[model samples]
Target: MDFNKKVIALLAVALLATGSWSCKKIIDEAPLDKLDITNAYRNVADADAAVIGIYGQFLGLQKTYILQNELRADLVDVTANADPYLKQLANHTTTKDNPYVDPRPYYQVVLNCNDALKNFKLMVDDRRMSVDDYNKHYSDIGALRSWIYLQLGIQYGSIPYITEPVEKVDDIKNLSAYPRISFEELLTRLIDFTEKLPYKEVYAYPAGNPLVVTIDGSSTNKLFICKPFVLGDLYLWNNNYTKAAENYEKIMDVENNNTNINISFNAYKVGYYLSSDYTDQSVRYLRAQDESTLLVDAGWRTIFSAPNTSNVWNIEFLWGIPYNANYKPGNPMIEVCSSLYGKYLIKPSQLAIDNWNAQRQYSGIPYDARGKLSYSTTVAGPVITKLTDNIVPATNFNRAGKWGIYRAALLHLRFSEAANRDGKGKLGWALLNTGIANTFYVGTYVNGAKSPVSFDEINTMQTPYAAPYYFDARSNNDYKSPWYRNTGIRSRAGITALDISLQNNVLGLEGKLIDEGALELAFEGNRWPDLLRIARRQNNPAFLAERVYQKLLKDGDPNASAAREKLMTPANWYLPFDWK
Candidate 1:
């Protein structure tokens, strides 16, 4: 069936159905046409399938979403055989006709979410869904809908806002003529809608319920499309640093919301888990035919590996989406860069490689676990190895890398960024907990006397580093300086300690946090957005241009000057779309 025709039919079903809706026990073949869409709420199974179908639509967005977020950023560059659209995006020269800019896929999801939202009330009234479940789904649908709008707003600047689905032909026609809303307004709406979701508890289908589904081995949680997480993103983009940090903390801190839910953060354990031994001479790092292990960050890699039930609810994945080859197009993200019958559409830029190297240099560290783990060790180049599926060989078309929507590490990185926004006063806490610093302090004024601040006092105040220092210093009669008052920070005894590096200064702190983000989130489709947020926060276009220039220089890009100048234009920062 043609795409538009299918959409029309689906909408018709949403609007016109009057009979009982029934679906097969199997989710993949939910018999949308066989069941009455309007009456789908008549039973628990049907209502569950309806909601699952909305997730299914979101799952289908891997290809476009990855390209839009990753390519335009400095992380990945296009290969020779890459689609022109991909190249256009990589070069920051996207035209109005770039197919990737089309808003249809997002709208399809909106339609699905709207359909579910419109009918879910009937499910609650009819006892097909519990009132609690109804509230849970209410938030779910709202988050998903807001996410689509947010993505559209981010990618294309302004877009027509459609909260309700087009259930009739006239509705479709009317929406087609709807004027575009400003990005600010779209963000406001997105935040408002997502805020309507419950932030207290995570929601999941009952274990035996047919409504339950898995993304890889990890099961689904309606709360995975979480409100706080989405709202944090909206707030982050809106430059509301304090709010963004608060919301993100709700996900990463776990202690707050995961009261009954146990979520742990194993930073070293979060990368791709490759076999301990593999002899692929073309692959870097794994050259030895023996049982040689490549640099592995198992926990970090786990985020992109085939879902493991043991780690499904792990704190590493604050919010994530798993791809099932059986359900949707097997994650196109992994295959797009492989030697195995892949388009090799995107490859990591030399700058991405340099980013890892630079961070290593800054910290005087020899090997960056993330750099070693994320980049291909084999001669296959610097493109990330984070998302490869060990179950699938590189000789095959599908590499089975799970795409993550949000990870706990990413939250930490962004929280650090959010904490550092201009005049936000979150820097002290951000610095303490980003876990990037090794030494900290406790300030004291003995007997409330103006004792001369001594180096020994500062040195003696030092404590071994720990993130989220449970206590903070308050600036008052006891502590006069911001540095003295900073949480978990006494004061550096001296900057001359060869082994004791310091980020006590604001610029140094921001630079370290940004570098940490680059190192940890290299090709995870976040580099550009990270840059954008930082640029806006600092109110400096130079942050955006200089970073792009550095990437261009590292990548040895020829149009560095042209691209740098183009990047200076705020309008060009966003892609052009053929809205008409």
Candidate 2:
């Protein structure tokens, strides 16, 4: 089909619509009748509209993205009310005819991005847009396109790596003209493309700009994709461990001066401690002091349920797409996961519950707070509320929620993955289990003698390779340094630190990181990709196949054996690319 023709049709519909774009926070209040194909790149305003239009089209892919990424994984399962397509996804019986397998929506967004990139360059050449503005817009769109392509490669395995705008979808179908590249090749190309971009930072919009909108009193600056995050992932996937760790450090270290240990990006941490009470239940979990009194602690749940403006929420959510009920496409997750007022098509699997239940909290609690608050067992059934907590009986039909793309926890986990591979396994493990303060030590002088010290006293001396590699978690007497504020990931969840004796080697620690990812970010659509990436990295099909097989078998699926046998072959892990 002619993709540009569809773009024109959508643009016409958008011109007549009154609602604002849902995901990107770009409010297009200006008249679009004059912004036709001919003059879409004439000036800055027109260029901005074109970019917003691309995001507008991107809003439609949220449902497919989540389903494809989650259903095929081990964390989520199809409900009785789910359609055959969803069941097919969960069962690994997906056919080419499944609507979710159709790659048109993804390619549509790619076409729009390609068109925008081409026009932005022409506008620059014609002196219609300034160099700085061109760099910002170009880099943003480039990173976005690369991200979409990355998703496509992950889901579909091999894809036509088309960079230029094409007249028709068939153009990409011709393998001779545009050869399909493997995921590894695609990663190399994406890293090279993203690395060469002029802008490497998040897109900075002017104050009060609609793009920099306020959703629930929080600025949407984090919604825009960061170049470093994309590049970091690319490098990590490509097995360039050092480069991946360096790129991730760029986001973790906001001040860019690792030597200045005091000024660190503490918000990226999962913990929320400011005092000496390491086992303080008040900051970690809610407990009953007496029959009449119940203490409240919004520890891990706050990451999902709290408003974007809340410091507790904003600190962790690095990038999320906010959905409004008044927009064209409301939050699709409500219908997919909510059992109250929408079609509960999917639910959390028993394996996920078992995994969470097997853990012990730091306070010796039976369950992890994250799993307890992630999803609850309702009278109807088990519902996934991580993304649909905003929906209630009052406004059930008109639901509004957010689709989380990247968060600080995920970033930290990915960074640890890269670091462990790069021979920093001990540091990576410390960051994941306990804070650096507890894991490392230093010598302190008392009067005239020197003695070994840990935690607070260790703060006086910097960590080994304190520049870009080390992450300090010590809170000195003053408690003023940014590094002091960060506790480890498990510390934030009120969970006990992982036993280093059980997982001391790099391979064992890599497995721990993957498990930690599932525990921290199960339903946010990273499970399958994580499993697949690691399985591919280790060249162990059993790593991914066994988890999926167990999930199906535990759920009493009849096709579990068949799916396991099929997944034994790495090629069966991806969706079939037979879109005609």
Candidate 3:
């Protein structure tokens, strides 16, 4: 053979082999997907996979522009931006041309949920899954569907409860073949389906030490947050607050029974409070509420770092979801670090300092029954920039090279100082009720530094958060002079520990939180469709006003004259609504 010809021939052979190898790799990398229902619905594992398909609905449930995030469009302060999504929602009589304002995005959640349900229903048989678990999973899917529809109704005011999968293109040839369901009727069905569904119990216990049974009553509390009957069960949307409170109270009772989210009630403790006790750990009341729900594990992380927190029951929750995220949009403390004070170590906001001084009252001082502060801050300034100080910081997990924020603690989870006192003054101020202090110290790791920070320069921010320290003329009625502290740790440690605060707040972010649209659940993926359903945006003027005013007080109050002047108007809530 000619030398040139042999070279060309060898190259061709090598190319063919490489191409073949690539093809094999793609096939191997694909999910163990068996889309054909007819061929595979005969065994337990097959059933598991089929059910897994339904789980996809939940995949984006917490992700953006889907059900949860979409749902935030309705409430006052759920989304970061709410308008553009509203534009897409085609409210016929309204000027908006898009069907869902945030139309296409929400439908993705709905469509996927419908597809999962329809496909699973069609292929369901005795062969593909374990009969018992299969039914449970099936019901779980139904529960999820009911929630999706409920969100749809809330967003669009009407929706077609699509039951069957669009098996073929011909099914839509006649336009009238598929009709829309009214919001009222869909709402009823949501309740109907949710009624019979059993809670899908999935217990997640810490490794090795299995004796605790789930910290929230084992698997018994694994209930749905958005079941059909949830409307009647907890009441929702406009006029739902009262019943919602009752439902939350009911949940508290149940959780208490399981000893999952019990507040520390032991009478024998001395604190600044004459008779007070509370746990710092909190929960969101979503799914799988348990005793350990508030105990944020060093590993399990969530959207909130525990600062952007609130109660579905107004203020009954143990913790609220803060918007702090480590590598994403924004992290409360870490992001704050990038601010003038956090970045330059000019000192945390004066607001945060005030808040810290107020909270410190309970640690070493006292409070009276009439909601009066009975003591003062013995130690002020930079009360606690890190959560590790609140709990026994974990000492177990060490450096394999990865930076460790928290190790592990033998202490039960706690949120604010109140977590330890529980309505009786064990720590300091007597428990008038389960109250959380608004003040905390914000010290600096390095005094007045810029860009790179030293370990001792970390600081905190608090302005009007503190309780008045006496009749000092400098203090407002609800204000306290903020204190500062110099800490040995870095801001990273404080921020990382905050992540644990949110993830473990099953008590506040209880596993049973129902109807949490993406607004409050923004980015968390629980609200999109619901936001669309309500025709509201997460950061709508009204919403942002509330968030800035209440939910994100730490971020700053939107009601401030400066905030109003700078960011007033619902338009700020608008987004691109790019479901296209």
Candidate 4:
């Protein structure tokens, strides 16, 4: 399958790859002495370096990073089963993993950004670099820093916004306050930085920015204003829906959006399933018939014989960045790319299938039991490889080729928190309250003949569904529970398991972070962030209100399940941040 192509692009950096003198100390030598974000600059490959340093913050990513760490729902461990991990994560069973503490990481990224900002200021102030170098790098780093802060503010509520470089030599104590700005203030700052950024041209400006300009005029265009989606997402998160749409639109709109990639869609969707030797004429067909057209990004990537969609911005995704744990590049924006907030449970969720079934019956759409697709050559197509590294002869690209980026949105993330929780929730229907008969039967019967059966011709008269009995539960129960007779669930025919109050801790609350109306970001892995940022990940006493009603001791609610026996409490929210 194309799955091999998924993890191919990410490479670990070597000491030598970090060529700069100062940076070499960081890469080749040892990790920084202080491991602090304070002493850095934006030069000497500094922006890349600082970004990488921030990557350190993500080291403890998979641990108790999320609040209410519940894995029993989808039933997967938080560590493995990558796809399942994501599916369960969306279920609100856990907090967002690997979150950067606000003020700390934001300030860290800000330090890196301020370093670059300072350098850019130096470029403009002293006229050290030429016009081309100045503008290109200026805009490139400008966008980079802007993207960092944008991430900072979005993940953490009200960050201590800092613009200027720190006076590392003088004093860091006289720094900006740790107070946060309003969401509007934060969004505005992001807009300001994003507005000034030059897109699709990561090459530093002037006739010759140092990074891209070779000594002998040869070219080495490492980082540039060229990344496709960086700017698009900036506007997207800012609630500039029109602007966001425009950015994503540019990746496809032919003349307006001159894209360079093949499967001009959010290739990350199905792109993860590509092979290493992805460059082939056959793959071109996949790009030709791209599906990235109708996307939040969209694509017809599987149209031709090509393998799958291309990672073009605006085409598939208006823009997206891979979660570069290093380079501090893996922003929350695409940390899990095609992944969801609900990580896949070691146990898969039947939710998707259930929804599909319900939809099929209601909408008359056909259903495929193999409803979910995974990235395996056996299943994901060119997404994964066979026994060994096998490259088949190139043919026309397969239109069905997918890298797994964009997709249909999720309605609900399955629940997977497997705690032996006993916190019960109580919802009672007393015989006295409804004025029903105080006497309750042993089961779904009135201790007599044919227990109030509600007849349905299909299950009885019709031969196709013929049976001695039909489930006459609901209507039958209506008759039994009524003290007034023939109305309540007293004479029911279906088995009525004992109902009990919901107790124990199983927190369940979810909301959008970047309002879905703004980003239209359907639940992939958003639930974790939602619970974390709002500090709602905790299961406290306040989260649960004890229901103390004087009800008969024996009679209980019938709808209760063992899963609900667990209560929704404050401790269930999440483990403390450093506990992981």
Candidate 5:
């Protein structure tokens, strides 16, 4: 770690931060002296530019995040043409020299965030920045830093939790000062840091705010890291089920009005459902008759390909990083997963294909439409085309693709995971299978007698949960209600509901939730984390190892046994923390 190289990296960040936005003129007009930390944060505009610059540095993480999270999971496998580095990841035999194993890029973002957090506090104390702006920007950066640290711990196992700004490159090499902490300790630190933040809301900029950058006619407001999602995820990993559910419920309750009159615009709800009538493109989808006639409709795929302006797309995606070909950091996923115009480095595993194929649609159809919609069988291999579909024909390049961070399906599935562990297995099962409203309102018979729904259940279903830790899904014959709109994760996928008996078996319900997360979130960079989290929670490393083993066996890999053996040990699950 040369000092000159560190200086060059910081300078590069300054240039990138200044120019990353679509409206480059504002950043370009800033005085060169303002780029320095000493002069930066003197005003609101300067603070905004500094935060935007941090985002520019974050763009470098897109490739590593997906590779580390997906390549090592059960859903994704490397192609024959993939680099040896990628093959090592899939085989769980990563070397120190593997480029993806380098943790400097992750630390770079953390360092930037550390610098910004310190300066923001000073600005607020000096009255240079208002409390409102300080809360919004400070929490945004704090959440971002916590998220990066979490990713580091998840991938590298034990990592040095460095909070102070590293003025010199050599400072990081002194591990004696900042000792590496276990993932459990890291979670405790993050939960404490995130829970105490002044603001927990999304950073929604005003109409004429300079921070609002429009990319290719689509306005980008989802750049900031979601604070509640971060806190929820931290609590989830730490095994605080009730606290996790509470934080997640906060995000889901964003659009809920306190009134009893239920309206339809709940962005947090998984409102998409299958329909034979293809009149409403937003909420309804036509089921494919069979495997051969599986139509890739705009309904499901639009979650990834649709523009940010789309209401349906907005409802699903909570945070996304916009990419443009003309920009410095172009879309990395296109080159990684695309077979048509890109490298075709990796493809979906046979296990993933089988998982999707085994599912029966709501109409009892054999195949899951999401499988075909997510990827396609090509001459080369089964290429994953989820985010890489919108390619520019003129340039033969992917003109745009969003790196999605959080979404409704992932949120709901995670909530269900927490709820099940918190002894709310019935509520968890309903969200995972059918809508909450449908489950409670349509009461089942108990020993020839129709079980009466409780008053609290009925009230919550009809009015919808606003505060505390209750959830509602009953439409009460009014389809416009937000609770009624939630058709559950499986229902949105046009899949049949799981048996009601499984709800009582808490462990079984947890397993089903993980399975549903795979089918829904697959390559969105959540499979590995979801699997790892549950395995750790249950204290069963085999839970994760067996799945990876099965995937390897399905692919006919000779090293499947060895890989499974390695993964059985909790210590071997994380990448080596060898990078200085």
Candidate 6:
């Protein structure tokens, strides 16, 4: 490649990619002037840059991460225009030659975290940072490193989990002696690492302070992966339901319940109020420019738009990957899914579409609010709208938006599954109530009184009562129904729906919970893992094979029989990684 081409390639791979892990080679070859770990901690600004650089590594990983998680699942299928790379991933036939399959990028992120941890103490001892800040950095870097390892373990099964930085060629050679750690071991480490963090009850950036300052001087307050949320997710994966619930309770503000969260295009200026109940207080803190749009409800569609701005920080979202329009090669989802630029690279499977439309509450509308809001009707089929929008200008498009890591809705469903698995009937009931209906409509008035309804009250209302009470109640409070959020729909009075039934058997419950997860987290990148989790939980590969069978059948694939046979093999659960 020419110099210009090589620079462009590096920019595309290093800056544009978005996976959670990084390559060791990427770290080894990164220009010293750009990072310079030795002198990087000389001052507070230097330390800030070092930490921010680690986040940048995530920006590079976001695209790959979302694809690996979403495309490999049964819910979505690649478009006809999709490159061979994407098609291979969607078809579960990826080869070692596939450009996107490398784990080196993720290893790069781990190495970056190691370097930061290694040098941070020097800064603290030099009095450049307060002990509190030092502790925070330690926790932050530790949490980030563990998160990368968790992703690595999930994707690759086992990896050479390294904690030390590879400063020279010798370090790389020595790494060959390190043995790969099991996924269970990695999860245990994550649990321990997150528990030891400062354990702040709540995480909010200092008032008026930016969450992280970018290399170009832009700033944002998008939350990073915090302790309770990470720990809770790890616990859920570990099947420690009680422990998971305990960790989630610490940071999740259940009292302040609002499902429809609105974010501004101007992210740094937004201030989220931390509370326990959902009310006007949610909007009271939104920084308004002209006051006319002060409480202007951001469309449910806007949350996925570029410059995605979230007004309230409920326990729902654990962390978000921040994107800036000023930065080059913005969110990869937009590049692939946006109407203007996207050539429909990723398409929704017919089964996913059928599953979405099956819960129609009325004969008048063929699709639920989630179906309507999350997809666009094109001749090509239903294109994923959960992560793509056209509001941003074409020239300035692809910038601004965050990929959700772990949210309350997903966590709630996971807890519900875990509770059901362990026979914790009552706890499962409460978790189901809170988790599914955790939207903007939770704490609003009923009968003109400040009546906060339990999740069960809202979720279980019979048919003809309007999906979420009624359009009247929703319009009166400016609350969008849970249908748009994919939480669950309320059939009018006394009508039992497939999703509404609290099935008794474990398989029935797991199937329902799995469908709910697909509805709530379809394109946000958890579908494949959700499927694998359920299959593993039951110790049955048929659970997974059946889903794949459904997808292939829906696609009218002639090879469906053969594909199902191959997929039923136990070793097919997770793909083999290049490094391992």
* Root-mean-square deviation (CA) per prediction: 9.9, 6.5, 19.0, 19.9, 6.5, 9.6
lDDT of each: 0.55, 0.72, 0.28, 0.29, 0.75, 0.57
Tens-place lDDT per residue, model 3, 1-580, is 4443343233322221121111111112322433233554444344433333333223222223222232232221222222543322211112344443444434444444555555455544524444554455566566656655655555455445666544343432322334666555665666556655555232111222111111211111121222323432213333233333333223222222233222212100101111212222221112232312322422112112221221111112221111111112222222111121122111122222332233212112221100111111222222112311111121222100000111111001111112211221111110111111212222333454322232222222222222211101112233322111111011101111112232234233221121211111222223333223122322334333332233224434243444333234533333322222
lDDT of 4: 0.29
Candidate 5 clash pair list:
437-473, 437-474
Clashes in predicted model 4: 165
Q: Give the TM-score of candidate 5.
A: 0.87
Instruction: Give lDDT tens digits, candidate 4, residues 223-334.
Output: 2333334454555444343454344333322222225233322121122122322221111212322322211111222211122223232222221112222232222222
How many clashing residue pairs appear in each of the predictions shown? 18, 0, 166, 165, 2, 41
Off by over 4 Å in 4: 1-103, 169-176, 198-240, 254-371, 374-580
lDDT of 4 at 97: 57
lDDT per residue (tens digit) for residues 1-580 in model 6 = 4443343233333332332223223445755434445655775555555555577676677777888877777888777788998877777777877877788778777887888887777778889877766776667777777777777776777778788777765455455467887877878877876777663433533433223323222223444566666676788789887777666645433222343343211111111232422211222213433222323233333334424233333323556664554455666777777555666788778878887676543333444445555677787666787775533555544454566676555656665676666664333433343222232244556574335455444543211221111211122233433222222212210012453245356667667778876665678888877877777667888787778778878988555666577768767656667653
Candidate 2: tens digits of C-alpha lDDT, residues 309-400? 55656567667656655444477888788887689999999989888998887666677657766888898788988877654333655656
RMSD of 1: 9.9
Top-lDDT structure, candidate number:
5
Tens digits of per-residue lDDT, candidate 1, 412-433, equal 5566566655343233333333
- Error at 5, model 1, angstroms: 32
Evaluate model 6: give its TM-score. Answer: 0.75
- The estimated TM-scores of all candidates read 0.74, 0.86, 0.39, 0.41, 0.87, 0.75
- Quick one: best TM-score, which candidate? 5
Which TM-score value belongs to model 4?
A: 0.41
Q: After superposition, how far is residue 354 of candidate 2 from its true place, in Å?
A: 0.5
Candidate 2 local accuracy as lDDT? Answer: 0.72
Global CA lDDT computed for model 3? 0.28
Query: Of 4 and 6, which scores higher on TM-score?
Result: 6
TM-score of 2: 0.86
lDDT of 6 at 114: 82
